[model samples]
Every structure is written in C-alpha cells, then in structure tokens.
Target: MASPARPEQNRVVGIALRLCAATCFSFMAASIKLGYRHGVSTPELGFYRFAFGLPPLILWIAWSRNWTAWRTARPLAHVRRAVIGLSTMLMGFSALAYLPLAESTTIGFAAPLFAVALSALVLKEPVGIHRWSAVAIGFAGVLIVMRPAGSQLPALGLALATGAAFGVGIVTITIRQIGRTEGTQTTVLWFTCLSVLALGTLLPVYGRAHDATTWAILFALGTAGGLGQLFLTSSLRYAPVSVVVPFDYFQLLWAVLLGWLIFADHAPATTWAGAAVIIASGLYTLYREHKLGRDRPKADAPL
Candidate 1:
C-alpha cells in the first residue's frame, strides 16, 4: 500500500493532473466524435481503443517486473471499478452518438456536480455550504443545457450519462479510500487491469475496422487517453479529488471547438450560455476552496 502524500504538495500536483486529464479526455472525445461520422458504434470503438492499447501497457508492466504493487487487497473492488468505468465510457459515447458533441460534453461535466454530493454522502467528506451551493448552481446550468422539460429527448441518453457520473463518483471515492493502502502506480495498474478485462467481454460485438486513417485516429485516442490516466493517477497522489474535479469541464470547450471545425455546427445561443454558467459556477467553487485555505497549500498537497 502507498502512503498518503505530504499535505503540502497536494493541490499543486492535483491541478497538474486535472489539466492533463482534461486534455486526454478532450482528445478521446474528439476521436469518438470522428468515429461517430465514420459509423463506428461506441462499443466497437471502445473495444478497438482498449484492445490496441493494452499490449503496450502490459509490456511496460512486465518490463517493470514487479507485480507486488500491481496486487490489490480488494480484487472485487477493482472489478466494480472496471464495470463502472465501462458504463461511463459506454454511456458517454452513446450520448455522443445522438447529442451534439458540445451538449454531450457539457452535460457530462455534471460528473463533478454529482461527485460533490456523492463525496459528502459516501466518503463523509466535509463540504461547506459554499460548495453545496455551487453544486446547486451547477445543476441549474445542467438543466438549462439539457432542457429536459422542453422536449421528449432520449431518456436513456440522459439517464445513462447521469448514471455514468454517479458511477464516476463511486470510482473516485473508492480510489481515495484504497489510496490509504496503495501506491499510485499500483492503483492505476489494477484499475487498468480490471478495465481491460471487463471491456474485453464485448469482443463479440467488436465490428469490422474502417480505413487505415480511422485506425490511426483510434490509436492516437488510446495513447492520449492512457497518458491522461497516468497524469490523473499521479495528481491524486498529491491532491484531493475535490480540487481536481472542476477542471474537467474544460473538455467541453475543446468539444465545442472540435464540433464546429469537424461537424460544421454553429454553437447555438443556449449551448454557449449554459456552458458559461457551468464554468462560472465551477470557478466559484474553486475560489472558495482556495480562499478558505488561508495559507496557500502546495499545488501537490492533498486537501
């Protein structure tokens, strides 16, 4: 088991991790966006993305030649993480298929909003009124972007994306709890193990490959996504999930830009407005956390 990082370095490391993860997720989202036009279903794309990427990860793990950290005290928990992760990817991609990329990206940003609530309940973390209020405001923005009341959208897309967020919160808290006993690399390796194995179950549906150009895009997606996971794991060593959570909304900015360039969709007024509200609320949450710290904590210091 890995020890907790010194509290002084937590926030610094966490922000770096969040920044990298945001980029990786944005890259992956872009790839998924491309795949959408190519007629690649989410499941098929995910299978290819993970499968092609695994051999290198495996070789790297084997080259390190130490299985000690790779072992987890709670194997079943890893299984659960894998399942939830698969659910998250599946739901997010499914949303991508139907919704405009920016809208899907914006709604998925609600994962942090979900995390605020879940962390309080499941992890028993102390979240002050300001954070709670931020959560409420964030949800209001989500409602505006989703406009669930205005139309009969696909219930499954909304439900699955939200459920995926709930699952993301669970995975996050689980990683935190387990971190008390696990090294960052060990934690990452184990989760990757479980994720690959679980995602493998969909092999039967893994469809035919597209042209070589599409293959290149998927490969880049896997590489960037893997690097993103690495940065995130390292950042968690220094910081609390709460500190890094909000930056994830940054992905929507990339999504919107990519949607415009690739799909030729002009940003609607509501999409941009809802995005501004969400980003504002998230910034407010970060401000409160930073201000309350009084003494500025190390970027890598965990809360």
Candidate 2:
C-alpha cells in the first residue's frame, strides 16, 4: 500500500515538471523567432528542428530498449497525427515570424477552448453548459487580443496563430484517440519522423544556413523542442491532469520575460487583459470538466 503523502509528493513534482516544460517550450519559441531573424524560413527551421531532435529521442529509445514500441498496429493513425502536427508547427512558427512572442504565446492559450469545441463538433463528445460558456468566453478573449480595429499586428499573423492553436486542439484529440493503443514514445517518434520527412522535402527551395552560429542555433532550437516535449509527457505520468494542467499557464510568464529580455518586446495592456480572460476561462473549463467527471489524463495533451 502507498503512503498517504505519496500522491501529494507526486502532484508537487508533477507541477514542477510541468512548469519546467512550460519554460523549455517558451525558450523554444524564442529560439524559433531568433532563427527567423537570422533568415531561417519556417519550413527550413521546422525541418532542422525535428531532424536534430532525432538523436536524443533515439538515444532514449535505445536506453529503454523498447524495440517493440517502434512497431505500431496503426501506422496510418501515426501518419495522421504527423500531418496535423506538421501543420501546427508551420502555423506556429509562421505566427512567431509576424507577431511578438508574448502575444503569440497568449493566443495559444485558446487551444483548450478549441479542444472543447472540437470535441463536441467532431468527436460527438458531450460537453456541458458550463464548459460551453467557458469556450465562448475564451473566444471573446481572443477577439480582445486581436482588437481588429486598432491592432498593429497583421491580420494574417493573428489568423495563423489562432489557427495554430486550433491545430493543436486537433492534435490533442488525435493524441487522445491514438493513446488508447499506443505509448508516448511511439506517438512522439512517429510524429518527429514524419515531420522531418514532410518538412525535409521543402529544403531545396527554402533552406539556407550560412554560418556555424546559425547552424548551432538551429540545432539548439530542435533540442529545446524535443526536451520540452519529453518533460511535458513525463509530467503526466506522475500526476493526474487536474493537478498539473493549470501550471501550463506558466508558459505565459516565461514568454513575457523572454520577449522583454531577448527582443525588447512588450505586450500591450490589452494583450495582458485578454490573456487573463483566456486563462480564467481555460481554468474554469478544466474545472468544470473535472467536476463533471468528463476529464481524462489524455485530455492534457501539451499545446
């Protein structure tokens, strides 16, 4: 039998891990933007990012010696996830090129709200009124962030970022469905492999890295992305979704700090206000889902 305090300890560690994941992902976004500034196109940056990440993932697999994990009964399912995942990466990186990091990160908070809507419309999953209300409020928050009338950010950038969030939501759904029969390693490995292949094809037209420093940055970008994903996946293994999901909000803090420190970019007051609304709505939706017994660990797929 386990001690009473064991669960609490796990929850604490899980929250810490989740926070670490958030920080790593924030830095990854910053690196992507940095790479863009150095003339790396989105496709090239994304390809190298996944390509460099392969070594670490391969090493982890070798260490675990789970060769069977590499074999999956549902190859097509993995391909589907990879396609959606690639779309998410393209939209996300493209958004980073056009928008400030903090704003892009804040807009990403809409992912869970999108998940709620997608679940209802596509999955035919039951969502109660409270969750629906939260979703509506969350979209309103997005509009506030957009502030179309006087917004300085390009409309295309906002659309791309929002689309990225929705793409993440779709990925989340696929992850949940695929997770029923697949392990984390399988899902991640397949996605990385597929993304590399898909993104690699565009290298002939868009790829360019002229210096050692640029090459190093591209490698670091991929490493950070891979490690951040590992950290997020590990966190859920230790604690329930309800315990660590909220800590994902920490990404906003890291984003704000990184944007200010690295790029001297500051989000306007409106962005912060909208972020608060989105955060509240996301938390409440999670709460309502948990309360209604509709929440599951699979629902905590990383954005």
Candidate 3:
C-alpha cells in the first residue's frame, strides 16, 4: 500500500493545478476574443463553448467512475442554475466583444464584491463591518476602472460586464444553497450538460460556417474550458479553498499579457490601480470570512 501524501505536498499540487486552471481559463478568454474577431457570433461562440466542453466533462465522469455525479435528486435546482449560468455566459462573451480583454477581465474581478452583497441580502448571511467595508472599497475600485465620467469604454460593454458579475453574484448564492445538498461534481456536470442543451436551441438562428481558423478557435475554447474546470475541481480535492482560491487572481495577469500580445492592447494606469484595489479588497474579504469561520463563497471561473 502506498503512503498517503503529506499536507504540504498536497497543497503544492493544489496550487499548481490552480495555476494551470487559471492559465487554461485565461487562454480560453483570449480564444473568445479571437473567435469574435474571426466573425464568430456571440451566441455561436456561447453554444460552441458548452457543446465542446461537455465531452471532456463526460470523459472525466467516466474516468473517475463517478456515475453518481450524474444522478441528481435536485432537477429543478439544476434547471435554475443552468438558466442563470447560460445567461451569464452570453453576457460575458458579449462584453468581451465590446471591451478590451484586459478591461473586461478587470470588471470580472468585481464578481466577489457583488457576491458579498448578495449573500447578505439574499442568503441573509451575517455580514460584519469588515466584509461590508471590503465590498464598498471593492465597488470603488470598479468605479475607478470604469471611470464613468468621460469614459471611453463602451456603455453596452460596461453594462454587460457588470450584469454578468451580478449574475455571478446570484449564482454564488444559489450554489451555496445547492451545495448544502449537492456535490461539486453533480453541480458542475448538470450545469454543463443543461447549458449545452439550452444553447443548442440557438444554433439554427446563429450558427454559420466559419473558416478553419475560426473553427479551430472554437474547438480550443471548449477544450480549455473543460480542462480548466477539471483542474479547478481537482485543486479543491487536493487542498482547501483558502490555499488555492487566491491563485485564481493570476488569471488577470494572464489576461493582461494575452491582451497585449495578441490584440496590441495596453491596459491604462487606472485599470491597473483599480485592479490592485479590487484584488486587495477581495483578499481581505476572504481573510475575514475565514477568520470568522464563515463559509467563503467560491467564484467559479468565467466561461
């Protein structure tokens, strides 16, 4: 019999998987932008993301021999999550079409801020002064990044990005409720399968022939998304959320680099400054939640 891995080794493995997941997701976002540039419609991209993503997840289920993950007692809960999750995906992909990747990515950092408020209001979770203060400062950071007055960013993009974040906030709360009775694999598997089914209905309207390059981009987008989901799921298996969640922020850095390299995009000083503030606020919120022994809400990687 093999000895069990030590805690330190497990943590190191978790962090590595977390970082890899971040990279895959970052690359996935870049692919979304690239696919848009290649004349792939937002809805088409959305459909492909879930359709292609489902295969790898199914493979993972088979490999793990976790057939129970496919059997959920909460059908209505899965439907509800799928509805919200699919809408969030379309809004996020549309936002990428309107905003630079880096800016879109920065706006995404606000999801946790929205989650805090949603938890307090919807979940009626206890919110002390510290978490509330963190939420306030985090919104301030979002404002800084938006620079609403004399802002060059597109209004549609800002609205879509912000809406997506808000949707994520609601999803976070919903996940907490479902998570009490459901395993992560069940939640993820049902959401992905349902999303693929729901989005497939739109194909007759938005689907079109694309060049080989565009097809390749779509394929890569779904594959990376599936792989990222796997890595993220596995990371939690190896280490606690507190150990790996912080590395999720590394996706922003990857976004910046990819945006610059591929799109000749340069994020402004305000964007960087705001990202720092938002990240700090988020980190502090996590710290306070852990300190208070509250269940820290998890932010799923963006589609």
Candidate 4:
C-alpha cells in the first residue's frame, strides 16, 4: 500500500499535469485557428488532427503492452461517443474561425454547467441545490459574455460555440457511463480512430491543398491534441477530479494570451468579467459535488 503522503504528492503532480494539458489544449485551438487562416476546411482539419494524433496513442499502448485496450465490448458506446465528440470538434473549430480565441474559450467553459443539467435529465442523477445554483450562476456568466442583444460576434459563431459546449456535456455524460467498463486508453483510442475514419471520408469533398506552413500547422495541431489527451488522462489517474479540474479554467488565461499575441485580439472587459463568474461557479459546483460525496472523474479540456 502507498503511504498517506503519496496521495498528496500525486495531487501535486496532477495539478502540474492539468496545467500542462491546459496549455496543450490552448495551443491546439491556436493551431486550429491558424490552420483555418491558411484555408484548411474544418472537415479536413478534423481528419488530420485525429489521424496524426493516433500514432502517439498507439505507441503508448504498445509501450504498456496493453494491446487488450484495443478490444472492447462497448463498440456501440464508442461509436456514440465518437459521433458526438467529432461533432463537438467540428463545431468548436468552426467557432474558432469566427470568434476570438478568448471569447470562444470562455463560452466553451459552460460545458460543466450543461453537464450538471444533463446529469439530472439523462443520467437520472440527483443534483442538490448547491450544484443547481452553480449551474444557474454559470449560465448567467454565459449570458453576460454573450450579451445576445448587443453582441458583435456573428450569430452563427455563437451558435456553433454553444452547440459545441452542449455536445461536450453529452460527451462527458457518455464518458462517465462508459468509464465503468472501458479503460482510458480504450476510450481515447476508439474516439480518435472513429473520428479519423468519419472525418477522413469527408476530406475529398472539403479538403484543400496545403502549403508547407499549413501542413506544419496541421501536424502541430495533432501533436498538441494527442499530448493534451495524454496529460489529462495521466492527471486524473494521479489525483481526484476536484483537485485537478479547477486548473482547467487556466485555459482561459492561455487563450487570452495566445489571442492577444497571435491574433491581436483583445477581449473587452465584459468578456473577462463573464469568464470570472463562470470560473467561480464551476469551481463552486465542483466543491459542492465533493462535499456531497458525489464527485466523479471529469472529461479533460475541450480539445
């Protein structure tokens, strides 16, 4: 058995891994936006992202000699996860094309809120007042950021981003349900493989020729995405959900920085304020879940 202090050390390491995952995900978003700027279509980008990402995951499985992870009794569950997850990726990358990175990222933060409601409606999970209250507060933050009446972001962009968040919430619930029987590698493997096959089929219709820089950007997107998944999986293995989840909010900061530096995009005061509210609500919700002894492993970054 491990020493009592061992868990504490794991928590520390998990926090670090979560932070790294956050950065990798932010970089993935930036790379997606960069790829779009170079004339890559969303479908093509999605195909490359998943296809290129597979090698790392495959190598890891081989290193661990966990070839059994490839075998699954839950093929339908994986197919369901893959379909929804691929839709989430397409919508999210599309949103990045139309919205500033910070704004799109802030909006994506609402996934946890959506997950809370879905838990009750779909999973028949009982949610207490505290979690419900947090959900409400988080949506309020979303409204503040959206300011639908006077918002400058294109309506389609907002719709896609919100849709992506909704898709993520569904993915989260599916993950929790299937997590009972699937190893982390199995889940990740199936999702990536299915996404690649699904998206790759559409490439001929949507794909465009890429220059050297664009090819590099696509490769970077895949690398960052694959590494991000790995880091997030490792983090959860090392620590409890409550301990490392809050670190995910750090992606907003990374998004802001990357947006400003790469795109010269600066979010207004309202966006920042709304992000703060969302972050606070999410942290509080996680805290409440922990207190209620209902904490569960959460999906990692949106990427």
Candidate of highest lDDT: 4
Models ranked on lDDT: 4, 3, 2, 1
- Whole-model lDDT for model 1 versus the true structure? 0.67
lDDT-best of 2 and 4: 4
| Residue ranges of candidate 3 with Cα displaced over 4 Å | 1-9, 295-302
Off by over 4 Å in 2: 1-9, 299-303
Go through the candidates in order and give each one's C-alpha lDDT.
0.67, 0.84, 0.85, 0.87
lDDT of 1 at 105: 73
How well does candidate 4 score on lDDT at residue 29? 94
Across 214-238, the per-residue lDDT of candidate 1 in tens digits comes to: 7887787677666666565556556
Q: Estimate each model's TM-score.
A: 0.79, 0.93, 0.94, 0.95
What digit string (tens of lDDT, one per residue) describes model 3 on residues 32-94? Answer: 999988988987888888788888888877777677887788999989988888898889999
Off by over 4 Å in 4: 1-9, 299-302
The 10-residue segment of model 2 with minimum total lDDT is 1-10
Provide the lDDT at 160 for model 2.
98
